[model samples]
Target: MSNLLAKLISMKYKGKSNIKEYIMEISNLASKMKTLKLELGEDLLMHLVLISLPAHFRQFKVSYNTQKDKWSLYELISHCVQEEERLWRDISESTHLSSTSQNKKRKKTKGAAEGSFQQKKPKKDEEFTCCFCKKSGHMKKECPKYATWRVKKGLLVEPTAK
Candidate 1:
């Protein structure tokens, strides 16, 4: 009898099952205690049900406490089911919103990187600067002055074009 009472008090809802099943399980335990000559009041049973719920039901518990009227076992089940649905909806919506924003940010960053790379690439008709002469229109390797200096220094053999 003491064991049954202790079990009833220590029962916790871990969300492994639906709210209705959890509440009914607790109710069954309370009924068993009653059969063993340990009578618990209806109000106490309601409070016990509330206490067994997890922290996710904190707002629901607070609302129940602040209300002027009390709820029966049936009303408690109904309200709890409604609150559970609302919580699930809120969770799904937030997850979707966050994922959508993340995808958009990735696309924007990818587009910006591609645009910057394209801007840095030189066009076919664009002029180049010669590092050897500090002039435009050709690169250092193709500079006329650099070729003459290389020929004078015997660093290059002049190609005879026919």
Candidate 2:
């Protein structure tokens, strides 16, 4: 870092690099270094993240908040990181349900392999009747849609489309 700072200071303008651009380049370098360290250890980055906010209120040596009363840079950052960590933990816990879902799905597939999820329908009579339309030619076993149509019209409850 000392060597990099010395190099940056020793750099000549030569009408080639703008002053703002040079300063920004230095800033970018510093941020990259910080990011590398943060990846290595979150506590280090977390501490800095909490302390990054500005101190807008001060009463002599002590500070006070004029708006909501309580405030400080480090405290604000700590709160933010705490909330963020809590949110992440909640999300991870919720996704754990998906693993249970996968397990349930596996059990269902295993039950299916055992051939217990299916039932044999009774043999159809010579003549069948439609439950909804009340026709005699086709049975309710043939057309699920027609059987559900009357129920939907009468009670306003839709059966599963599938």
Candidate 3:
């Protein structure tokens, strides 16, 4: 009986389980203490629950301690449960905001990649050769063969010397 009571007193809260479940577990231990002819009042039960809570609830414990308001077991449970919900809500909201921003960034990067898919412009220093005359020094525009062909086809008139 003493060992069970000690176990109840020493139990610590693990974050993996829900706060409500933890509270229920503590309540059961307190009930067992009562059956064993031990005195386990609501106030003591509340104290045990508060102390057994994880370090995440440090702020909650501090606020509860500083205030003049004396909360019963039911009121404490309600407040703790609300605090748990608020903590998770804030976490989920921040995660959602970050994911949305990441998606927007991904879309912008994809758009930039698509724009770059077009053919790249040739650099200024790079020279092109004439395909018509098979020459390396000049382009098709300045090729003699092309000039003669254009003149014969009447596409361009011969220039007269000044």
Model 2: residues >4 Å from true position, as ranges? 1-70, 121-162
Estimate every model's Cα lDDT from 0 to 1: 0.88, 0.50, 0.86
lDDT tens string, model 2, 82-109? 5445555877887998889999999999
lDDT of 1 by residue, 73-129 (tens): 889999988998898898899999999999999988998988953546458988887
lDDT for 101 in candidate 3 is 100
Each candidate's root-mean-square deviation in Å?
Answer: 13.2, 16.3, 11.6
Scanning candidate 1 in windows of ten residues, the lowest lDDT window is 113-122
In candidate 3 the C-alpha lDDT for residue 74 amounts to 76
Q: Which ranges of candidate 1 are over 4 A from the true structure? A: 112-162
Best candidate according to TM-score: 1
- Residue 97, candidate 3: C-alpha displacement in angstroms: 1.8
**TM-score to native of every candidate shown:** 0.67, 0.32, 0.61
lDDT of predicted model 3: 0.86
